[model samples]
Target: MAAVRVEVSVLPDSVLLQILALLPPWDRLRAAGVCRRWRRLALDRAVWKHVDLSQRRLSSGSLWQLLRRVLPAGLSTLRARGCLLSASRQRLLSPALLSALGKRCPQLRCLALSETDLRRIPYASVPASLTALELRRCELPISWFHPMAPSGTLRRLLLHHVPAFADWHLMAASCQHPLRVLSLRGTHRVTEAGLLQAAPQLKGLRHLELWGCGAGDATMGAIGSHMKQLRVLEVVDCPVSSAGLGPLKSLQGLERLCLELGEKVAPKAVIALAQALPRLRELQIVGACSGMDEIRLSLSHCSCSHSPQAPD
Candidate 1:
């Protein structure tokens, strides 16, 4: 009898990571501990290109251990895809881990910590490479923005339901970079003065979203006049009207405008917007504002759609 020899080809690190990315969290963690080579490969940033830690059922100690073990040596990008951290569970994320991440991931650029507590963020320390940041439903203090971030690299910023902006002056001063995109939805404390102070710094801005804020016509006009590069302006759930929209007519570069019509904008408001801002490509009117009388607009490159009813 003769013994037969067999051999199997080994997959490359990149290919192995691609395979590991498809596995569940626990399974991936288990695979990382298989061997030294496997552990190193699994911890590579490529394996976490699109991390989704939603409903992972991870304990505080276990989460810290996993982050310490699995996170790559020098990660350049991180996406906390829509993870919810309850008050009690927030303790699981240690300040040490956050600080370590800030110091280690100096090349990190994009961060999406949606629906997580901002108290978890060591605001005093942050990666200099951060450019795009999304903080949704995060409870951060006003002092969080006092620490000057790496300004030259920052571009996009989104803050939703953040009450910490009562002293919005600090935010304006800290955000000195020319932002391309800015969104502050449901930031009740956001005032017109704060926006006015910040608009000049964001001269290169193209998209601005200010929903459910107190900013009226004056604020919009200020931004429209300065941001010559502004393209898309969305001011839904605000008190601004078509008269306030009048200033945007000169914004030859403007493309999209989403406004919520109310007391400030009468039935004749749409007529003025259509007459002016000929470059506007898209217009959306929701809530009570959409009930305005339909005005026939003849524009070749523009489209208009309005909801007769408010969002349910």
Candidate 2:
């Protein structure tokens, strides 16, 4: 008997699409040239819903070509990290490209741009349908967050190492956008006063993370007073001491609390936090002092019925 022969073309379109979906973005693009059927399956909306160009060194022309030829209108998430960097002082993400993106990809929901300069790009050029935006180590305009409208769909925002994110931008974001989750790291210019003023306006915020943002007792107090809806809070490398932890006790809705403390915060403060918040489910305390062993022992011996998880 002759040996049986098998071909990928024998597979159903659904199965072929499932196989193609596992390939990398560039690999999928390459696979599209194999055959007409394969091309149609490779360019299916389901296969290109999320495109990550972080690893690729893309120029403006190549990006434009990809947007026009490869990226589907059903694309929801796009992460372009360090893809458009140039040695010369030329903007890779021109207004025309941004406008085309907005018009072409109406379903774009989440966009993340890292290690890219957006100082020249108008804030209004950002896609209006985005529910999440992440900008890391990017040079932003002075009024980046000011153009966001209150009626926009943006819910989550992460700004890492964005030094230009000042109090005015924070205030504008708090007032204009209905953000539910906000993370700020290495934004030292945002003072405690900024938190005091903006915390109240972020009534819908549930998860907040602040790292090296100069938060203190007053900032915590303001959060406890205004941000009653906050469920998860992470404060790392801030100026908050044991005294500052007192205000956090009033956060009845808080479930997960992470604090990276220095010598100023004592072991007992961690115990107090574990016992104070009624809804506290997980408590992570990273002490930079020599009493970390003692802190662990104290936390282990604490009689709080909540039984907070051990620090990670």
Candidate 3:
């Protein structure tokens, strides 16, 4: 009764559109079916600027319908995963669909695909407007990691659990951009040499993460020498110690540092880092709990993760 009494037409188009933009792709479709006024406002191009359909699967015909009905031409970022994109396959999205998306969404700036089959993606299929890309657990060709990368536009690249990813792959990738962030998690094959080779290319990188991947002092040294503007550094479940990490002192802007030691790091190395990164806001250290009490007590402000887990 209340919904009927309140005429939605009286609500400014801007307010209704804002409400529509906040809904997920599935819920947004449901809201559009509510009434004619909402359908008009929901169809506004700006509402479809960023569409993430990572949780649902759709048939090729269904995809075409969704694209025409809800996806606007002005889409800037599109994230799709677990989708039945091909008409023949129940769980695979065809490269043809990917190509169509790139063509239709000219303004697309960011693309993230996880748990998707990217077996046949072609060269130049990604829109040139893209600046950020994240791929995880996908069946992608090695060429997509290098030759197909949007060399001129990409500024941030993240690869997580990509079986094809390796140290040499990063070595071959286009490194023209001073990338802002390079996160390679679950890419165990990448090592010190691979990161070192790519470090020089990503001099402007601010956030660096090597989670659950092997890393050593050389990797730390490479990062320190190249990424001088690095702000956040997290190296979890990697074989890294305080020895080579001393180079981090060169980073004047470093704010947060989290290290999960895989080897016994020297105490002096920890002290060096504390003395070097004076502007640090949070410093978390795990696995080297033996002689860290004095160091932890000295830098009371910095949080250290100790055995049995220390208080926050």
Off by over 4 Å in 3: 1-11, 59-61, 83-88, 147-150, 174-177, 266-268, 288-293, 300-312
**Per-residue error at 57 for model 1, in Å?**
6.6
Sort by lDDT, best first.
2, 3, 1
Q: lDDT score, residue 19, model 1?
A: 84
Per-residue lDDT of candidate 2, residues 1-312 (tens digit): 999887988989899888888778889988989989888988999998988887765566777888988788899998886533565334457667888998999999999887777877877888888999998877878877774554667799899998788888888888878899999998988988998889888888899999889788888888878888889998877756777888888788888887766566766777777677777766666545555555556554232221122132
RMSD of each: 6.0, 4.6, 4.0
- Arrange candidates by TM-score, highest first: which order? 2, 3, 1
lDDT of 3 by residue, 1-312 (tens): 555577667878888888778889788778778888777777778888988887775555666667666676799888877542443655445666667777787788898888766666653566667789888886666665564354566788898888778876676553644478888888878877778778887787889888766577888888888888889988876756657677778987888887765466766677667767777878777555566676676665566555433222
Clashing pairs in 2: none
Writing each residue's lDDT as its tens digit, candidate 1 over 232-255 gives 987877756666877777677778
**lDDT accuracy of residue 135 in candidate 2:** 87
Cα deviation at 14, candidate 2, in Å, is 2.4
Task: State the C-alpha lDDT per candidate.
Answer: 0.66, 0.79, 0.73
Off by over 4 Å in 2: 1-11, 83-90, 147-150, 289-312
